[model samples]
Target: MSVPDTQVVVVGGGQAGLAAGYYLRRQGLDFVILDAQATPGGAWQHTWNSLHLFSPAAYSALPGRLMPPQVGEEYPDAEHVVSYLRDYEKRYDLPIERPVRVAGVHRDGELLRVQTDSGTWRAQAVISATGTWWRPFLPAVPGRAAFGGEQLHTVEYRNPGDFAGRRVIVVGGGNSGAQIAADLAYDTELTWATQRPPRFLADDIDGRALFDAATARRRALDAGRTDTGGVASLGDIVAVPPVREARDAGLLKASPMFVRLDRDGVVWADGTRAPADVVIWCTGFRPTLSHLAPLGLRGPRGHIPTADTRALAEPRLHLLGYGDWTGPASATLIGVGRPARDAAREIAGLLRA
Candidate 1:
C-alpha cells in the first residue's frame, strides 16, 4: 500500500530519458530515471559493431551536451556514441537507477503506480521513453519455423566476420538492412530483400538534410501552407561511404520479398528458390510498452494514441522515442530532445498547478 513518491518517474535512461531528465532538472523537479540496462549507455551499447550515426557527432547529440568529436571519424560509431551518453550522464549528474526493469504501470487513484523489478514508485506523472531497440520485429513468413538455416535479427548481428563465406540474405528496406548488407557483401555472398526497392538519398545527402527537410515541411504545415513535397524522409537510407561503395560495386541491390521460407532457403514470389545459409532480418521494431498494458491505452495495433507526447487516454502518461506516432521523429537521437522538452514542460505545469 505504500510506495516511494516523486514528482515524475522517467521510465528510461536512454537519449529520450536523459533529455527529459535534463529539462526536468532545469525546471527543478524531483524526478528519477529508471533504466533497464545495467550500463550507462542504454541501447546504444548493444548496436552492431559497424553501425555509425548517419549524422555528425554534433547533430546526433541529445540536449544540453554536445557529443565530443572523434578523431578522423565523420560519423561516430556505436562505441563512441555509448561513451558520449555515459559522459553526458556524469556531466549533468542525472539521477538514474540502473538495471531496474519496469513491469507494469496502472492508475493508483490520483497518482500513477509504477511496478518494477526492484520496487514501486508513485509519481504525479510518468514518461515512458523505453525506445524500440528491445523489440526487433520480423514479419511472419510461411514455413519460417521449418527453416534449418541460421536466422538472426539485427539485434543479434555483431560483425560480418561471423558470416564469412556463407550465403546471407539481408531483409528490410531501411538503413539497417542496407548497412548490414553492405557490411556482409565483402565477406559473404549477400542478397538483399525487401517489400519494395529501397530508396537512396543523394550521395551528398545525410541526416542533416533529412532533418532540415522534415523541419521545413513541419513549418509549412504549421503555417497552413501546403508542404513542398520531395523533402528527404527520415526513413530514407543515407548514402554513407560504405553504402555508396556497395552500390557502385553492384552489391546494394534489393530483391522482392520471398513468399515463404523452405528447409534450405527461401521461395520467391516468382517461385524461384535462393539458397541462403543465414538470414538476417533488419525489418524494424515496435514500441516496448508491455509495462503500460495495465492502463488499457493501446489500440488494436498495439499503439497508444498521443497528443504529441502526452497520452490521449491518460494525460499523466507521456510516451517518448516510440516513433513518429508519439511525435515527429521522436525515435531519433536528435529528434527525441524536442518531445522530451515538451513533455517536461507539460509535466512541470501539471505538478505546479
Candidate 2:
C-alpha cells in the first residue's frame, strides 16, 4: 500500500478529540483533528445557559491543562467551559480544522479513507471522538404525534425563559431531566416524569466520587470480578446546586412516567391526566456515529463492539469518549484522558511496527 496522508485523523474536536490530540502531539504523530463545530468548546457551547458542572473546576479538566477557577462560583457554568476549551486548543496549538463535517470513514487498502465535506484524506488510523450530544434521543412514546403542545428535546432547550407561564412536562430521570426541570420550576408549571423514582446522590457526592467509582469498576471488570455497577449504582442525578435546591424546596418532585401523550398533555398509568403546554424530553442521547456506518461495523445493540477504545472488527479505528463502552466515564472531561492516552499510544505503536 502507498503511504497514507497522515499517521492519524481524529474526528470531532470536542473534549475527547482534544484529549486525543494532546497525546498524539506528544508522540510526535502527524494527525489532523476535524471538528464539526464552527468554533471551539465543542458541545459545551450548545448547552443550556444555566447548566453548571457537577464538580468544581479543579475536578473537571482535560488532559494537560487545569480549567481555571471561575470567580464566585464553585462549579463552572457552560460559558466558562466553552472559554476553557477554546483556550485549550489555542494553548496546545493542535492542528484542528473547524467546521469540517466528516461524511464517512471507509477502509482503503492498508489505510482508512476519511471522507469529509471539504475533501477526502487517508490515514493509518482514525480516532472517532464524536460524543453523543448531536444525536438527542427521543423515545417513541404513544400519542406523541398528536400532542398539540410544542415538543422540544434537551438539545433545543437554551433557557427556562422560553417556558415561562407555560405548563410543561419534563421527561426522563437523568441529570439533564433533573437539571432542566429545576431550571424551570420557578418559571413554569412543571411536572418531572421518569420510568422509575429519581435517584439523587448524597449532597456530598460529586464528579470526583463518581470518577473514582467508575475507575474501581473498570479495574474490577478487568480482573474478571463482578461489576459494581459504577456510577449507576450510586444515583442518577448528581444533585447539583440548582437541582438540590429545587428538590429541597419540594419543587422538583418526580412523578411516574406517563403512559401516553394526549392532545392537551400526558396521561399517567393511573388514569390521571395533566394538562401541559409543552413537553421537554431530556431523554438523553446516542453516540453520533453515523459517519462510521460506511464501515458496516455497528453491532446488534446499535454500537460498534469494541475491546477498549479500538473497534474489534477494524483495529485501525478507535471510538473514543462515547461512554463506558469506550472507557470508564470516558464521556466526562477528566475521564477521557486515560482512554485518549491509551488510544494514541496504541496508534503510535502500530505505526512504528
Candidate 3:
C-alpha cells in the first residue's frame, strides 16, 4: 500500500487535537487530524444528556474562537459543547479525517509511521491527543462479578430515565460522579460512594476559578515555589445547578466506598449491605494509549513519561489531554490551549530545523 505522508499527524480530533491543530495551522505546518469518531464532538457526544460544563462557555472554548454564549443556560450542556467543537473544526478549516481509528504508531528510522484503519500516515512528528473517554476504569472489588444486577461505567450512561425507580449507586468522587449522582437522585433511589469525602469548591467559585488556581499552581511549581496549598484542582466538584439542587434536596451526600459486592447489593466494611439495582462506576479513565504501546514509552502505571507534553524518551512525539502529567490541567478545555501551543511550537521548531 502507498503510504501518505505529512509533517505532522494528530491522533485524535477531540479538544486536545483541535487545540493543537489551531497552533499547527498558525505555524503553517503540513498536518492532518485523524479522529476515531464517525462524527465530530469527540467524547462530549457520549456524555450524559444533562451533562454541562462546570465552567461557563467562555471559559470552555478552544484557542481560536470563543464558545458562543447560551442565553438561558449558565453552563453549556453536552449538545451545546459538541456543537461548538464541531463548529470550531469548521471555522478553522482544520484538515480532519473522521472514522479513522489509529491502530498503532511505530518509529521508522527518522520518521514516525501512524497506522490507522484507512491507511498509514508517515510523519515527522506525532501528537497523541486521544483522550481517556474510551478507557473507563472499574476498581477490582471483591464479588464484583457475582453481583447479578446491572453494572455500568460512566461511559455507557446517557440518561437517568432508564434508571428510574431502581436502587442505583454512583461511584467516584469527581465531577462525573457528582453530576451523575445528582441527576439520578431525583429519578432513582440513589446512593453516592467515594473512596474519600467529596471535596467541593466554594459556592462562589466555578470552573474559571479552578482554572486560575491550576494555572497559579503550575506557575508556582515552575518557579520552585512550594507554597501552593490554596490552589484547587480542576477535578474538584463545581457547584453546577443540578448538583446544588441535589444538595438542597439532601441527596448530595456521599457514602464511603463499599468493601465488596453481594448478590443483590454492596457491603460496607462494617458488614452493612444496601440493596442496589444498578451500580454506575464513575471511577474515571485510563489514557487510551494502546496504539502507542509499540513505542514502548508507557510506564508501569500506563502513562507516558513526558517533559511537559513532549515525551521524555521520544522527543519526536507528544501526548496531550491525558491529565495533569501532560500539562497542568491539560485534560480540561481551558487548560489544554497553552500546552498545545507550546507543543506545536516545539514541533514546528523541530520541523524547521
Screening candidate 1 with a backbone cut-off below 3 angstroms (N, C-alpha, C), the clashing residue pairs are: none
TM-score, candidate number 1: 0.96
For each candidate, the alpha-carbon lDDT, in order, equals: 0.88, 0.94, 0.90
TM-score of each: 0.96, 0.98, 0.97
**TM match of model 2 to true structure:** 0.98
Better of 1 and 3 by lDDT: 3
Report the alpha-carbon TM-score of model 3 versus the true structure: 0.97
Off by over 4 Å in 2: 1-4
Show the colliding residue pairs in model 3.
none
Of 1 and 2, the candidate ranking higher by TM-score: 2
Task: List, residue by residue over 241-342, the lDDT tens digit for candidate 3.
Answer: 898889878989899999999889999999899999999999989999999999999886898988899999998999999877888778888989999999
Backbone clash total, candidate 3:
0
Higher-scoring candidate on TM-score, 1 or 3 = 3
Q: Sorted on lDDT, highest at the top, how do the candidates line up? A: 2, 3, 1
Which ranking of candidates, highest TM-score first? 2, 3, 1
Q: lDDT by residue for model 1 over 1-353, one digit each (tens)?
A: 34579989999999889989999999899999999999998888998898898888988989988888888899889899899989999999999998999999989999999999899999999999998899889898898898899999999999999999999999998899999999998899888998888888888887777666765676676689986552444446888888889989998888999899999989987789999899999989988999999999998678998888899989999999887667666777888888888899999998889
- Candidate 3 displacement at residue 168 in angstroms: 0.7
Residues 1-353, model 2: lDDT tens digits? 22239989999999999999999999999999999999999999999999999889999999989999999999999999999999999999999988899999999999999998888879999999999999999999999999999999999999999989999999999999999999999999999999899999999999999999999999999999999899999999999999999999999888999999989999988899999999999999999999999999999668999999999999999999998999999999989999999999999998999
